[model samples]
Target: MKNISRSTALFERAKQFIPGGVNSPVRAFKAVGGNPLFIKKAKGAYLYDEDGNEYVDLINSWGPMILGHAYPAVEEAVREALSCSPSFGAPTAREVEMAELICSMIPSVEKVRMVNSGTEATMSAIRVARGFTGRDKIIKMEGCYHGHGDSFLISAGSGALTFGYPDSPGVTKGTALDTLTVPFNDLNAVELLVEKNAGQIAALILEPVVGNMGCVPPAEGYLEGLRKICSKSGIVLIFDEVMTGFRLSQGGAQQLYNVKPDLTTLGKIIGGGLPVGAYGGKREIMDSVSPAGPIYQAGTLSGNPMAMAAGLAMLKHLKDNPGIYDALNGTANFIIQGLQKQISKYRLSCSINHVGSMFTLFFTDKKVIDFASAKTSDTVLFGKYFQAMLSRGVYLAPSQYEALFLSAAIDKTIADRIIQASNESLEEITK
Candidate 1:
């Protein structure tokens, strides 16, 4: 068995300083029931824990390492940039180049502004939408996390079938009132909310491909319906592509689904695993932000040299190799197929939702198209399966609510090992 003595001790020490001994809540492994693995380093497709045990990484640093950990080009770019120092409150040519590249890749974003994280991007986008539309209320899908922004933390309430209730303690009732929450893949609920709020709704935001509620994909007509509704209702549509940005395709979910929104929030792959985010869209909407217009959004480290250099290198690589998406999808499909065979052999009531390089295996027979169905998954069984996989040299997301992100570092050998590990884990958990 892998020795976790060091990791356990580290966690105990972290608890004295950091909340729950983790910077992020899920990393606490509360749902999976164990001391979280404290990774010391990562390379290619694997992570080495502080305990000196190795694991085939499935999280991929929460969907950033598309080209995989320690990518030569990105690493080189960051190293070269380090000699110039880290931050500059003023603008740089790299930021201009990065902005230009993003505009060229995502046509919907005629203009772009860099931020430090996805939460900042989403929050700023919502504020921009409200300022531009002269409306206060916004629509967001249930269980779709746009980060911990106060407005985005609202959940669905009993009234109007779309009324929102504050999910967190700090969120005010007034903030919840301005934010309407509806079920995913349910156009009717969105339509109802828009109709009820009529002319008051400023924007409708969602993950075109949700990863927060475990890789739940949009229904056949869902995106199209949303597009039509927003167009007809004069609501600015925002696609939060933090997870789906580069993972789905070159232009993100907007290009993959061919559904353009008025605004888009992006993170992950763009930073090459660094803290970076961007929100951009129609020229008119973007012009509403800062120096150019009235709405104010600014960041001192928004386009830091190191982050821009790293992101530019990563995006350039991905752009140069359009085939990466195909390869990623093929690998994800292979793993999915293998897992499915194991699921069948075990006679387990499980459901898998996969898209491109992102996937989630839910311990539920019901299809998890929305939060309601996703909640039906057996958490107890999944916890056991998670531990089983971990014990056998595989590392998955600590929470069932998160999706497993595959990296390009995974080769045929790594893929086979992951599948074999899954097979053993399924059998052991079921038995």
Candidate 2:
């Protein structure tokens, strides 16, 4: 159970080269108070750490592994693509194939342009929005993570929001001025922002379901209200479905909520565990980018062959098998219900929020509606629970602000194990 020795050794080596011994900030374990586990390999529902400790993984690479780690078809597709080539700055047939599949599957996406990460996808989308509408200001939802770009880095989520510093160091005050942020699921704040900005606002982008604040869904009529307001004022509505896109459903949160966005940003599952991102929606809006239009955005690895092939394989499999969602939802419900039962029985002062395959257990009694409410959760209590769960061979997102993703690879047995671990962990931590 002790991985401290291997993790410490790796951390020492990594800190010398990699900043904070991790590429991503959340992996630093500052909030959880332990060395982050160095995952050697993952398969199906389990992750094997450097010290050979296996655990039921709930993070699922932050919502990408719907079919679980190293899915056979996706892995095979990537391997086959590797035989040909990895990247080509020019066009590839696989990119077209991938785009076609994505557009067909995602209801709102008519013309998807590939990018290297969610940051690029969102950044490009915002640029396109400004170019198409001829406006400078954009509005984003508080506690909603779009990406790491300068514009999105303002009032961001995940690491930035978790640490209570939405405005990052390098992001200038001018960049922050162009981006206005309001609370999640707050339609009034959105309405006021739109009315106040009027013609100056180019677009309003948000996670349809606030995943960064631990899976807080939009209130009833919230998205519909935004849609109406945006349409009325000539403001573009962008759905930052980078986390919920393929994970929520084949058509993503847009289809799930029955709200079509002007622009949509997608990542994670599309890459089939590789690094890839895409932004697409109305052809008119997308046509404003690159050679076809004025705004230019390019990447050497934008449509990498391997990423395309893996994504194609993953999307094709999901499209072919419609039952994947049902299975994933059922598994997620099982875990959430189990955790709720334990919470009720033990009378724990916590709240659980779930949507499809994503869920979070917050250490608070208030309804986690927005960033303000989500902040009420006791971080010290969450840290205790996180450590206990880790000790019980269960892997969770290190930060309480992050969502726990469940994949289809997690069977009944794995779900049961997680539930049992939660019950035990709660008891141990609360005691």
Best by the TM-score measure: 2
lDDT, candidate 1, 232-310, per-residue tens? 9999999999999878988998999899999999998888889999999999999989999999999989998998999
* lDDT, model 1, position 128: 97
lDDT of 2: 0.89
After superposition, the stretches of candidate 1 with alpha carbons farther than 4 Å from their true spots are 156-166
Report lDDT (Cα) of residue 43, candidate 2.
97
lDDT for position 30 in model 2:
87
What's the lDDT for residue 117 in model 2? Answer: 92
Model 2 stretches astray by more than 4 angstroms: none
- All candidates' TM-scores? 0.97, 0.98
Per-residue C-alpha lDDT of model 2 across residues 27-105, encoded as one tens digit per residue = 9888888888898999998999888898889999998888999999999999998888777678999999989999998
User: Given candidate 2, what's the lDDT at residue 10?
Assistant: 94
lDDT of 1: 0.90
